[model samples]
Target: MARYLLKRLALMVPTLLGILLLSFAVIQFVPGGPVEQLVYQLKGRGSGGEAAGGGSSGALYQGNKGLDPERLAQIRKDYGFDQPAPQRFWLMLKRYARFDLGESYYHHQSVTSLIVSKLPVSISLGVWTFLLTYLVAVPLGVAKAVRHGSRFDAVSTLILMLGYAIPGFVLGVVLLVLFGGGSFWQLFPLRGLTSDGWAQLSMLGKVTDYLWHLVLPVTAMVAGSFATVTVLTKNSMLEEIRKQYVLTARAKGLSETRIRYRHIFRNALIPLLTGFPEAFIGAFFTGSLLIETLFSLDGLGLLSYESVIRRDYPVVLGALFLFSIIGLVTKLLSDLCYALADPRLRFEGAPA
Candidate 1:
């Protein structure tokens, strides 16, 4: 297992390098990059003022317009705009190697610092949603499978299918309208992850304050996601239950509970292991982009969204790079879980 894991880890370097190279190539080749915007700044022309770095940059550009060609060359060289793609990419990789992700073009903050600052809120919301999803889905699925073809199963199927049909963002909008300061219940805060003056609150008060804020967004997130897991769980459990071992256990006078849980659910859990990484990843630390935007939660997803809109390339690249690393690591972790769950997935020397 250790040797197999080390091999995979070694392979990740080139894989991640490929991903980064592709991303950098696309961003670099795309029109209207940071350097081109600086051109607008230099010309003192407002080709959309925001892209030109606004009034101060325009003034700075105007001041430098009368400078000698040598100064202009120096400026371009300083920013690496004069370099070819290969050199630029190599430089970027070198910077990343030293953990210097560069400063945000617009925010003027270190990219690492910016991402770190926003990561916690997304993680907090994600973890709560993850826990909620598994807590609700797994049990409901088991019950549904156990009572297959009964009224309870029928009702759950209908509800979950309905949820599956409705996209998460659409459901979020509906929920916001019905319960978020609309003509309906007006039961929850319209946006944000905390109330005013929450920082000044006592510990328990702070907990309640955050939970109160969490209710609606968490509701939207869970309601949108839990249905799929419930279905997966139910199907896996049902398949395991119908296997010959389950029948043999029942014939051997094992209680229904023992056969269902010990034999069936245990095996059923193996298939579901594949989903754990995706489930946790999509909710626990880095998903719910639309939902976060709707609620005005300051998270990495929303930051990436705004950065893209504003053409804040450093922030965009930094956020993407961070998520890319996390995704690859999580995929590796999922493979590890697969081997742990099913002995058939051996890492030792084999026929393969």
Candidate 2:
């Protein structure tokens, strides 16, 4: 097992490098540079002033009249923007090798620090949303499978279809209208992490307030996840129910519940387990985007969106790198899960 795990871990290096290369190449080829974005922002702040540093803007001429060209050239050199693309790529690799992810031009912060600050909020949201989704989905799926084409199954199928069909942002909007703008507006807070007086409250009160603020965003996130999980669960269970082992259990006069839960459910869970890692990685990265934006939660997704709009390449690349690492690790974990769940999946010559 250790040897197999080591092999898998070793394979991940090349996969990660490929992902990094692709991401870097795409970013490098994309039009617009960090300098342009900075200039645009500065110009905007200057109230529709001419482009800074040059172009048709008279502002550049006025601003640079007293500044030395040599000093400006030194400034650009210090920032490494004077280097050719190949040199920059080499420097990026060297920095990555040393675990130095560089700095964000827009935020004037280390890439690591910016991601670290925002990650907790995204993680907190992902955890609660995933928990809610599985808590409702798994049992409901089992019940539906057991009932087959009955009313309970029919109703669940309808709800699952509707949930899957509706985009999270659309659901968020509908929820905001019903619970945040209409008659029930005061029932749930529209946005943010906590209420105004939350910090002044008792510990339990603070926890309750935080949970209250989480309701809408969590609900929006769970809707689609729950629908997908339910469909997968129901299908897996349905297949397991028809297997020969289940027939054998029934022939032995075992209780229906015992055969279903003990045998079928356990087998069904293996397939579900295979999905957990990918599902979690997806939820961690993509799920929070729409939900966070709609609810105004400041997380990695919102941060990435703002960075993209402003052409903040450092933040965009940093976030993509983080997500890529996560995806690779998640896939590795899924492979480990597969080996654990099925003896047949054990690596050739692997230790027992």
lDDT (10s digit) by residue, model 1, range 1-352 = 8898898889888987888888887775454556555555566655534553444345445545666668667766856778887998888888887878888876788999998888777887898889998999999999999899999999988998888788778888888889887767788888887888999999999999889888878877788667878888899999998889988998899999888888899889887787688668866557678988888888878888877655567777666666777788888888888887877777785743
lDDT of 2 by residue, 1-352 (tens): 7887788789877887787778777765544444443434444534222232234234334444546677656645756768887788778877777767888866889988998888777877877887788889999888888899999899889988888888888988888888886555657888888888987999999999899888888887788877788888889999998889988988899998899888899888888898788877776666567788788889988898877755566787767777877887888788888877777776766556
Q: Clashing pairs in model 2?
A: none
**lDDT top scorer:** 1
Clashes of each: 1, 0
At residue 288, candidate 2 shows an lDDT of 65
Model 1 misplacement above 4 A:
38-78, 349-352
Query: After best superposition, candidate 2 residue 35: deviation in angstroms?
Result: 1.0
Cα lDDT, model 1, residue 34: 62
Superposed Cα RMSD, model 2: 3.8
